[model samples]
Target: MQITLMRHGKPVLAASRWLAPCEMGHWIAAYDEAGVHVDAIPPASLAAASTAVIVFASSLPRAQSSARALGHAAPRVDALFREAALPFPLWRCPRLPPFAWAALLRLAWLCGYARGADALATVRQRARAASAQLIAAAAAGPVLLVGHGIMQRLIARELRAAGWTAVSRHRSGHWGMARYRLD
Candidate 1:
């Protein structure tokens, strides 16, 4: 089985809202007042994954936008492959202190949220679950799964843990495409 994980394109922030008590210490909100559109990478990474059988994207517009650029005739949207939900919004995390960060991370862990497991162990478990489902579906075909940054990393990490050598990663939260082949 082979799979590829890709991050979403740029996104616009929604209306401003007050932070929750748990988020008080760990949130720092920013604005792109004129909601900005994420620029498409001149050349997309999906083209390199030409051998893929089907393209999949997260249920988010940003991801769908990037998947459309794959040059594929059709890209399927998959909700199970959505990005990990951070304890706080992704847009509100520039000023959080270490303790608060730890607290939120702990919160994520305490909950049954496997996507943001808050530890490498949890990441591996979540990745394996996703990979197992993929393997069960098509044990001998190439598939593309577009998701968020953390999930992508966890997927790559799980692939490595499952004995895939030669794993590589691009910059965080940036456009990325990874290929994995299972022997």
Candidate 2:
């Protein structure tokens, strides 16, 4: 069976200006609410999605929109597959681009700087649970997941741990896909 963990399409939101560390909280909120550019989904990825027996999407707006772009008028929306909560750093730091804040926050989160947000351990558990669901669905046929970048990476790691092998990764920008197969 085949399984594909796909990053959602490019979001409509933009980092038009530099932001202070504190401003990133608001940016994160907007990012969570943003919809994807549906037209940007590559034809090849769309074709792959169309072949899936089941399509799943994180409950976030971006992910849900990506599923529709893949031709699934309605996909199984699962909050369990949502991206790990980004920790909002409330410390003083040099003002940087919004994307820079995102990258720094992610790095900080990895280094155990999460204040009261979703702990790293919690994310790992969710990844395992979501991975199991995909594996179960694979028994029936192909499964496609249109999810966030980091969430897709987490799921891919879980799939590899479960003995699935990587097939190919499409260079489709935000809509890129990491393919895996149980052989």
Candidate 3:
């Protein structure tokens, strides 16, 4: 009854410079080289067939590419797992100063403070809700969800809060692996 959520690996940037959008409903860009390099695959006790019956990813090319490279069969692109849309697209403007970036991250966190809304809170809520749905729908098995960084982090937090045992956070790459042992 465990749900393992892992973030996608390192990707080549599709944009030359960071920019933000001036409005909402903008299409989030995908990673150019989004899959893990073969050499970067990490060792893991879990595989696609083991406890992983369901695989979900954000509706971004990078996420989908990563899932495919990892040999996840029929990985579904779930909108709920997509990264929180920025108030503006990051690539629309010149990169912000370091302090400004930090402030922006903080603001993003605050904005996602509620559930089922297109904010960070909503992403977390969706991840958990999806996980719960899988646990209920699956008789007894492990599930895999390939998602973005923020969504994975939120999932880990929720799992920790629910007392599920999990692996330490793994860095970005094709071989990144994190596990949650749902009781």
Candidate 4:
């Protein structure tokens, strides 16, 4: 069985300004609601979306937009595939780009400061469940999942631990695909 995991297309939001911690909260909310840049989808990803027997997407707007952009019918929307929640801290530091803030906050999250989202352990459990569900679906034919970068990484790790082989690199870029095979 083949499982192709694709990151959703690039979001259409602008991140040119540095964001304060309080501003970051609003920024993340907007980011979550933003859709994808339809013109930026890679050709290979679009083709994979068309050929896969089933396409599953996170309920997030970006993933849903990407699924539709690929000329596929409405995908099975599953919150299980949602992006791991970002936990921003109230740091009294200079503002930074959204990506930079995300990097720092993720590091903080790893160090045991969950702003409020599920703990890392809980997220891991969810990944295991998501991977098992995908594996079961793959029993019939090839499957494609358009989801977020972090959750996809977690799911890929779980799949690897379960003895599945990764056929593609674990890329986190927009439209990047992670291919795995069950031998």
Candidate 5:
């Protein structure tokens, strides 16, 4: 059985503006609601998606839109595949661009700064469940998952632990793909 985890296409949301730490919450909300730029999807992603017998996507607009753009008109949607919640600090100074803030916040989150968001352990558990779901789906044939970068990485770890062999190097960028197969 084979399973492929693909990051969604570039989101339509603009992340170039500088923002205070406290203002990141609003940005995160907007990003969650934003869709992908269909024209920005890579041809390789489209080709990989076409080889899958089943497609899955996160409930987020970006992932769903990516699935559609890749030719899956109705991918199975599930919150289990959603990106891990990003936690923002309440500090009012040191304004940074959205991407910079996301990087710092993600590092803080990894260091145990959940700030009311789902804890890393909880997110790992979810990844394990998501991995199981994908593996089950792959029993029918190749499975394609249009998901977020971080979540895809977490799920890839779980797939590896479950005895799946990585068929390709995993990429963490938008429109990147990681392929695995159960031997």
Candidate 6:
């Protein structure tokens, strides 16, 4: 059985501005609500979507819209595939771009700074569950999951642990794809 994890298309919400750490919550909220940028979707992603017998997506607007943009009008939407929550530090100095803030906050979260977000352990458990669900779905045919980058990485790790071989390099960027198969 084969399963492919694809990061959703670029979000419509631009992350060009520098933001204070405390403002990350509002930024994240807006990002979660934003849809995909249709024009930015890679051609390879569309080709990958066409080959899947079943499509799954996170309930977040970006993922859902990405699925639709890829022509999966009725993908199985689930909160289980949502991105891991990001924790924002309260420090007011050193404002950074959204990407930098996200990276730094994610690293802090991994180091146990989950003041207002799900713990790393909790997200790992969820990844295990999500992996199992995807594996089950792959029993019938190829499965494509349109999901967030972090959650997709966790799920890919779980799949590898479960003996699935990577068929392609896992891509973490928007519109990137990773393919795996169980022998």
Q: What is the C-alpha RMSD of each candidate to the true structure, in Å?
A: 6.4, 1.6, 4.9, 1.4, 1.0, 1.3
lDDT for each candidate structure: 0.58, 0.86, 0.58, 0.87, 0.93, 0.93
| lDDT string, candidate 5, 1-183, tens digits | 999999998889764578999999999999999998888677788889989999999999999999999999999999999999999878898998998899998999989999958999999999999999999999999999999988899999999999999999998888999899998
Q: How does candidate 1 fare on TM-score?
A: 0.61
lDDT of 6 by residue, 144-167 (tens): 999999999999999999999999
Instruction: Tell me how far the alpha carbon of residue 139 in candidate 3 is from the true structure, in angstroms, after superposition.
Output: 3.6
> Which regions of candidate 4 deviate over 4 angstroms?
none
Local lDDT at 161 for model 1: 74
Which portions of model 5 show Cα errors greater than 4 Å?
Answer: none
The number of the candidate with the highest TM-score is 5
Enumerate residue pairs that collide in model 1.
none
> What does candidate 6 score on TM?
0.95
Backbone collision count in every prediction?
Answer: 0, 0, 15, 0, 0, 0
TM-score of each: 0.61, 0.94, 0.67, 0.94, 0.97, 0.95
Q: Rank the candidates by TM-score, best first.
A: 5, 6, 4, 2, 3, 1
Candidate 2 on 1-183: residue-level lDDT in tens?
Answer: 999888899999974588888778888889999998877567778888988999999999999998988889899999999998788767566789988878888898888878756878888889999999999999999999989877777888899999999999644458889889999
Q: How many clashes (backbone atoms < 3 Å, residues ≥3 apart in a chain or on different chains) does model 4 have?
A: 0
* C-alpha lDDT (0 to 100) for residue 23 of candidate 2: 75
Q: List the residue pairs that clash in candidate 6.
A: none
Q: Per-residue CA lDDT of candidate 3, range 25-86, in tens?
A: 22223332244433454446236424577677777766776677677757867776776544
Q: How close is candidate 4 to the true structure, as a TM-score?
A: 0.94
Instruction: Please write out the lDDT profile of model 1 over residues 34-62, one tens digit for every residue.
Output: 22254665354646446667777666666
